[model samples]
Target chain A: MNKASSALSGLYLLLILFFLYIPIIVMMIMSFNRSELYLLPFEFDLVWYQQLAQNDQLIGAARNSIVIALVNTVIATTLGTLTALCFARYEFRGKRVLQGMLVPTLTMPWLITGTAMLMFFFWSGIGRGLHSILLGHVALSLPYVVIIVGARLRSLGVSMEEAAATLGANGWQTFWRVTAPLMAPGIVAAALFAFAISFDQFVISYFLAPVGTSTLPVQIYSAIRKGFTPEINAISTIIILASMVLMIGFARFSKFGGER
Target chain B: MTSSARRLRAIIGLSGPTALWLTVTVVLPLAAMLVFSFLTVVPVGGREAAFTLKHYTDFFTRPLYLTNAWRSVRLGLEVTFFCALIGYPAAYILAKAIKGRWREALLLLIVLPFWSNSLVRTFSWTMVLSDNGLLARTIHGILPFAPSFDLLYTYPAIVIGLVQSYLPYMILTCYISLQAIEDSLTEAAYSLGASRFDVFRRVILPLSLPGLIAGSVLTFVPVLGAFMEPRILGGQQAIMLGTLIENQFTASFNWPLGAALGFIMLAIVLLIMGLFYPVLKKHISVN
Candidate 1:
């Protein structure tokens, strides 16, 4: 009975994995296939990727995505880490309310948030473009960064900072020397997470991006809706691989499935 | 400044920037949306706009909008149901049957695709479910006399794609809760002459309810607002509340109507969270 149950478990897991991976694998293979019609007996070629390089619009969008993600990572990581440190060290009066405010950004659908930002930005004359996109991305990412870094701070405990104080180290000195180094792994992991969130963000960017200028995901969305092409498959395969690699690095630093 | 004053300053300096940013970007914008929802027109660029409740009333007065809202709710329920059905068992095996490095690696693998680009992932489904796509070809190769398996641009296609996208969330949440359960509890129940089904129903299932509830809320909320999956997979059949709202902003440029629709969607989401708050509070500690 035990053996039979275990076998059933393995089969179920394998089936789920197959469902998750099949589309990704199909897209990757089709990117390499020479057939425009996605025909079988796959003849491999690099033609679509070569075409992707010359596709100025796609190349430009990809550059915009990377730049926004990098800027978002820097801003979100700094703000989020500081917020996490505050939550870790202090017992302020409005801390609960502040934490509660973070929930809507995480739980509320991006469609609502995106639309709300559009309405507000337009009315307030902030308007739409890359700066508006950056604002939205940072708001979405800050909560995750705080959560990740806060978890690590909790694990590290207050003893080190207290000890630094006893040894005649000032608050600034202690933070820079002791707390910062100890929290480095968590901070790095959170930054990578911020980068991934901003990079992969679609719904928010979709709303904020003006005509002729957009992020890679927004550009890809229009390309898919307007026309179907293997060049899309080429760009998508590259994005999936990049995001997967970033996530693997995150899983390593954060021990995402928990410590062994 | 005194030492105590300096300490207070440090705390403010640490937490102030993030709080201020969230207030500007999240709190104020949502407030602005609420105000816009009550207006007759978008108050922008010399447009003649006035305060009115017509946009909210339009939702009830217009049958098309009402039906689309209902459709979105139903889609949320269906996608959440399927994700739980498939994910709970897989999470159980990973948490209980597997051990050491293998379990960790498998868990990471399950969650990897979730962080990748959702637009790309949704588009990939179009490749598999199209008439001449891989699924149909493989089905024909096996059955030989089977009908063409064209699953694209249908309700089932949307459901399938949504399930694939969200299944990892269910598994991850369930795995966290399941891993915390002790193996000896099951052994003890078995020694007391409880059957496997009885043990699971009475012992394991009750303990894991929080995770299940949390996963359902997480899955349902996003599925409620999903526009991309249905557009790519459902095609003409893809008119949910989300897509309707998207059309208002993107196609029609009726910002007030879109704002009203968005707030209604948010109210529904908040209601679900409130109903599940008691269960979720126990699972997710605030600090």
Candidate 2:
């Protein structure tokens, strides 16, 4: 009976995985297909990818995406790590309110947040473009970085810092020599998360990007809306693979599922 | 500097930058949106705008906005229902049935797609669901006489795409709750003459409610505000609150109406969240 039940569970899981992955797999396979209509018995070629390289618009958007994601990662990681350290180490007045402030970014729908950013920026003369997109992405990624790094800090405990202080290390010394190095893995993980969040961001970029300037996701969205093209398939395949590789790197540093 | 003064400075130095950034980007924007929602026009470029409730009033007086709002809510419920139905079982099996490395690997596999670009994933669904696409071709190859399986541009296609997009969140949350359940508790219930179903209903269900609620909220809120999936998959059928708001901003350039619609969606999301606050508070505190 147990064996039968286990078999049933395995089958159910396989079905779910198939559902989850088949669309992605189809997209990947179609990217290389020679036919524009995604014909079967696949004649595989890198023709679309070759075209994608020379497509100035797509390449420019991809560059914008990478640059924005990198800058957002640095800003979000540094600020988020510091804020998380504050939460972990110091109990200041209104700390609860400050922490509660992070919830809106996490819980509020991105559509609402994105539209609000557009309205506020347009009204306040902060007008839409890459800069506004950067602000939005950092805000969106800040909470995740804080949560991940804060969890790591909690697990690492305060004893290490105390131990360093007892050994006559000053505040800066203790932090740089002990705390930072110890928290390196978590910080790296958080940075990767911020990078992924900014890279994969769509709704915020969609609203904030001006005409003739957009991120990759925003560009791809317009491409999809305009028409189906194998070029889109090629770019999307690269995007998925890049993110998956980043996530696997994240999983190595952080326990994604749980403390195993 | 005095030690106490230095400690205060340290706290400020640590937390100030993020606090200021969040205030500028998140709090002020939301507050500005609230003000924008009440205006007749965007107050910019010497555009004289006046305060008005007409945008909010239109939501009630005009049946179009009201119906679209209802449609979005219905879509949220449908997507959340399907996610729960599919995700909870997989999470359960992963937590209770599967062993160590396989469980970890499977969880990663399930969640990896969620971190990828959602726009790309939704576009992939278009390829699969379009007429004479991969799905139809596969079906024809097997049955040889089945009618056309053109699932694109339909409500179900949107649901399927969204379900695929958001299912990982449900599983992750459910797995967190399910993995926390002690095996001895199940064994204890069994030894007490409780049947498997009874144990699951009484012990497992109650224990996992927090994750389930969190997952549902997480899924439902975004799905409520989703426009891209609907536009790409539902086509003409995609007239939810999200699409309406997108149209106002992008097509009609009516900022006031769009802001109003966005706040309405935000209110709905907050209302649902408030209803589940008790469960969420406990779960969050535990984490």
lDDT against the true structure, per candidate, is 0.92, 0.92
lDDT of 2 by residue, B109-202 (tens): 9999998989999999988998888888889989999988689999999999999999999999999899899999999999999998999999
Model 1 residue B40 distance off true place after TM-score fit, in angstroms = 0.5
Model 1: per-residue lDDT, tens digit, A1-260? 49998888888888999999999999999999999999988999999999999999999999999999999999999999998998998888888988987888888999999999888888898889999999999999999999999999999998999999999999789989999999999999999999999999999999999888999999999999998789999999999999999999999889788766
DockQ of model 2, rounded to 2 decimals: 0.74
- Pairs of residues at least 3 apart in sequence or in different chains that clash in candidate 1: none
| Model 2: lDDT to the true structure | 0.92
| RMSD in Å for model 2 | 1.3
lDDT (10s digit) by residue, model 2, range A32-151: 999998877799899999999999999999999999999999999999999999998888886887888788888888999999999899889999999999999999999999988998
How far out, in Å, is residue B104 in model 1?
A: 0.7
Q: Give the lowest summed-lDDT range of ten residues in model 1 chain B.
A: B278-287
**CAPRI quality of model 2:** medium
